[model samples]
Target: KKVSEFIGKTTNNVAEYTALLRGLELSKEFNADEIEIKCDSKLMVNQLKKKWKVKSPNLKPLYQKVRLLLSAYRKVNLIHVPRSIIKAADKLVNKAINSSLDKDVEVHFVEEETESTLF
Candidate 1:
């Protein structure tokens, strides 16, 4: 399974958490009893596994949300892997970023043309 989204401007930590949240939502929708989440973010993996504390105030809310989502599953495990191991996910993220940038450039070009026509 693969998923990607443009979550706008956010730190790497927030983006990682957003991905986790979305995956949990999808799992619940499908009524999945067990889920193994693999990611390249070691910090997030550790935080969720309770191996490390979530010290950032900005991340506290996201950490709490993850905990809430985990309660819905009969079994869940978060594993950390090297970035090279998650090629598909990395490609998806790059595709989404490029897609959004292309749209932004198109919008800027159209706005410039519209302004020119107004003169």
Candidate 2:
């Protein structure tokens, strides 16, 4: 699943949190019990993991929203990876930004599976 949104100008951390919020919302829609989130922002990762405090007033509400959404899941793992690993996502973000340069727009692209398979 992939989602892209143009949320206007904002801090990078806010954008990271917004992306996580969108991903969590999608997972909830699918009734997923467990999820693994990969992000390139170390600050966001650490904040979610509770290893670092959310000092910014602007992020407190977003942090609270994340916590509220996370409570619905049985298990959630947050991982921090290098930006290089997420080049495709970056491209999607760029595409969304370029497309919404003149207007406010949010785009979501979900790849659906044709069949369910048991492992």
lDDT of each: 0.69, 0.72
Best candidate (score: lDDT): 2
For residues 11-113, what per-residue lDDT tens digits would candidate 1 score against the true structure?
Answer: 8898889878877877776887777667788788778777799999989999999889887777776556677656656666666565654221110111111
* Deviating ranges (above 4 Å) for candidate 2: 101-119
Q: 20-112, model 2: which lDDT tens digit per residue?
A: 898788887788777767777888877877879999999999999998898877777666666776666677667756665433335332332
- In model 2, which residue pairs have backbone atoms overlapping below 3 Å? none
Q: What TM-score does each of the candidates earn?
A: 0.76, 0.79
Q: In model 1, which runs have C-alpha deviations exceeding 4 angstroms?
A: 101-119
Alpha-carbon RMSD of each model: 15.7, 7.2
Error of 1 at 61 (Å): 0.8
Indicate which candidate wins on TM-score: 2
Error of 1 at 64 (Å): 0.7
TM-score of 2: 0.79
Measured on C-alpha atoms, candidate 2 has an lDDT of 0.72
Clashing pairs in 1: none
Worst 10 residues of 2 by lDDT: 110-119
The CA lDDT at 55 in model 1 is 98
